[model samples]
Target chain A: MQGREILFIVLSLVACFAGLGVVLAKHPIKSALSLVVNMFSIAFLYFTLEANMLGITQIMVYVGAIMVLFLFVVMLLNIGSDRSGMKILDLKLVPAILIALLMFSLISFQVLYPLFGMQYPVADEGFGSPEAIGKSLFSQYVLPFEVASVLLLVGIVGAILLARRKA
Target chain B: MLEEFISNLHPVLAIFVRIICFSGIAIMFVPIQVWWERRLLGWMQDRVGPNRVGPFGLLQPVADAIKLFLKEDHVPSGVDKFIYYLAPILAFLPAFALGGTMPWAPAEGLYGLLTPVADINIGVLYVLAISSLGSYGVVLAGYAGNNKYSLLGGLRASAQLISYELAMTVSLAAIILVTGSLRMSEVVSYQTGPLWGIFPYIQNWNLLTPTGLVAGVIFFICAIAETNRAPFDLPEAESELIGGYHTEYSSFKFGLFFLSEYAARFVFSGVFATIFLGGYNMLPVRWDILAVDFPGWSEWFYFMHSANYWLSPVAFIAKCFLGFTVFVWVRATLPRLRYDQLMSIGWKSLLPAAVANFIVVAVWIMVTNLYGMIAGYASLVVSAIILLVLYLNIKAVGFNESTSTKRRIKMAKFNLKENEESN
Candidate 1:
């Protein structure tokens, strides 16, 4: 009815379609690109929700950096050859379909059923600011924060070792 | 008429005017930048440059654009039709949009926005997001062109991003820590004082601080890489790739890539100037401070005191041009780096250095603020010792030196012992 709501709906549809495109696209690169689109639309959704910091972070980390790396790997591998050998009746499809159905039902029952058609509340002051996040992260979630960083450092070291051992 | 224009200008109308003016400034400067780089490069290399086309080849870019316009646009047989057409635009748009967050000038008087356009809280994040998105243009162009050279160039460009961007962001994080804000205007304003808290005599440009200087150097190197400038320009090493990502493009599409490269260079220079050098401020001291502390000298140095009022845009442009000249100078002076060396510097040296310097600065800030001068000095001494140790180790060993292929020497005693054990 209103302009903001209309805009929200449009972005939601874009996110949904891009999400579907990620799963349905034949080429891995195309799927990766669709995932990128989905990420950007989610960032826009964050913007509409007035979580400016979160929205920018989503774009900065996911769409800009992470997805670029994803696409780079995709391009480097040059997987242009179509690998659509599996038919609809393939046994591999059954487990995947069953898992998808379980996820759908679980999400629908737990989240969608309870929260359906409810208007989202506006964010409070400094809800998604760097200061807000930093304070909480340092105070309440310090263990998790430090652990995550250490984990990342380990991964980086492992990557260097893997590369260096070859040389 | 002027009064009427200012009397009740609507917000939307003002924004439109500002957008038009911003874009107009950028568009007009592209040719000038191209011409300036050409002439400067010529001067450095001892040649006349493009003096034949127009007055000092001022109109050379215009001629080139027209020629490109008239040239036949060709599409090769193997290229992806849709993506090939779409690639140029993706390459072009991001460069233009990258200039959005920069505070070129204040919006006092008849100018539109009071702060910079898009002065959102997450100014730095917005900039990082948009500039990082620039790699897409290269990747798409290289892939769509369906040429091996183009694809290699594109892949190199993305790989380059993965190496350099982490260091770049870490260096900027140091600056943000020092400033306590991410806004460009805030960063600039913070620089408009002493070099550090203690040094009242020196301008407080971030370049003067110990950790800040290290961060500044790292930031500039990363900027050079981000813009894909020489000597870090492995993506478009012409001798190797034969025009690189735009190898398959012809006519105006090729022109677009050329244009975007220069524009992005200029914008990145603006960003560097803003973050490190003090955006539009010509000097560190404020007018009020000068007038109060030494009124007689203030009259003689009116230009220093009054740069912030009306000359911000001019100051911004001059700084950008100076930065651009440096970019050109480096291009003329340095050879293109080998790809392995490029990666080595980005990951091993710059990244580690940036991370170390950032932690040192953060500790420096915390110590200096909470405790007395003694604590601050102690922290400084500790960091300096650590730096010295690291430097000595690096000197003693080597950078990215691998030694797996060296021949192994057998010890005589160990060999005899092993023979006895076997027997």
Candidate 2:
């Protein structure tokens, strides 16, 4: 009915399509690219939600840096030729499908029937601006911010060590 | 009807104008730069270059573009076909994306038309982040080609870029210290007025100040290396790796990579202009002079004022082109350094120079603020001393003496095997 709703629907469709492509694409590189597309579409959704910093960071960190690294490792292994020769409808797949279905049903049930009868907060003005995020990050989430950065640094050091060949 | 349409469609038209102006200037400059390089190289080498392609080969780029378009689009078998196709587009996009954040000129009076797509608060940071993304294309091209040469080229390129990036970031931090803002417009504004340091009598402009000049020079060299131009183009060295990362590419895909290189060169030139040269400031004191002369020359200056609006875009383009010419000049003059030499320059020389310059600048800022002395003169003196010390140390160390000897031994080992096989 409204422009914002239409945009949200379009973005959601794009994310769904890209997510499906991530699974369906035979080549690992193509699958990685599909994941990038999915990530980008999710970033668009974040933008529409007015989470500008989060949206940009999602694209910058995940799609730009991390996905490139993913593609790098995939190509280095030369997995392009591994696409063919297998079509299995296994008993193992049934359990995974059942688990996914159970999870989705549980999530839907929780959403529809709130045990505490509490409602989600409505979107407020300045909900996702830089000022709002900055205030919240510094004031409310200061420990988490510092902890996350430390964890990131550790991961970066670990990655460098793993990637470096034995001298 | 026309006036109403123009008024109603102003915002959309402004976006269109930017798209046209930026892309048109970039596209036009690419050919001009190519021709300029060929002619310059020709003059340097004592030979005529492309004389038959129309009037000293002025039309040569057009001819070359046509040829490239008509050429067969060859896809190498056993390559990652999708990624190989995507590589050039990825390579090209970041170069274009970087242009959006660069403030080409100062805002117009009253009407307030500003140059650049958007004056994002984090302009410098945005440019750095986008430029860093360029490594992805090179890395992807290398891996996707499924060629050993390509893979090695990509790995080397990524490593080189990552190494230089640290020095580049440190150099930028020095600029940020002086400017005190990440925004380009603020940085340019800070450069205005009689040159004085944060303390009394300190020179303001980064180019004029000692630490700023060193940082600027370091930043310039790092930019050149980052773009993989001559003296740092080991990723595509014909002598060693054949064709480097894009060896398997053909037709328009290859063209995209080629275009992106020139685009990147242009973008860096604009960046240097914005940072060191003072973007959109015509004369050093043009803003000051104009403010004083505005009322007196109101009638004539009105025409000049309207003309100034148009001139902002022209000034930006002229600055960018001047930057490109300098890049071309360096490419013509310098011989390619060996890969080891390139790494050593980045790691041993530039990195240390940048770090030392940053420390000197930081100290200068602090001491001047504390003692309340003549900050500009002190900063200049301190920076000069640091630079002299760095140069003396570099000279005394003898950059490549031991490394060249080791390389010679390695080459000798290869030669001995060849001789044994032949015998």
Worst 10 residues of 1 chain A by lDDT: A79-88
- Chain A of candidate 2 gets a TM-score of 0.83
Assess candidate 2 and give its lDDT.
0.76
Each prediction's interface RMSD?
Answer: 0.9, 2.8
Sorted into a CAPRI-style docking class, model 1 comes out as medium
Tell me the lDDT of model 1 at B262: 89
Candidate 1 global Cα RMSD = 4.7
Q: Reference contacts recovered by each candidate, as fractions? A: 0.78, 0.08
Q: Which lDDT tens digits does candidate 2 get at residues B182-257?
A: 6778877777645653432222566776677888899889888878888788888888889899898888999999
Model 1: per-residue Cα lDDT over B304-401, one tens digit each: 55556577888888888988899999999999999999999998889988998888878887898899766976897799689869877986675334
User: CA lDDT of B296 in candidate 2?
Assistant: 76
Candidate 2 Cα RMSD after full superposition onto the native fold (Å): 6.0
lDDT for every model? 0.82, 0.76
Q: After superposition, how far is residue B132 of candidate 2 from its true place, in Å?
A: 2.6
Q: Provide the clashing-pair count of each candidate structure.
A: 2, 3
User: What's model 1's lDDT at B310?
Assistant: 71
> Lowest summed-lDDT stretch of 10 residues in model 2 chain B?
B196-205
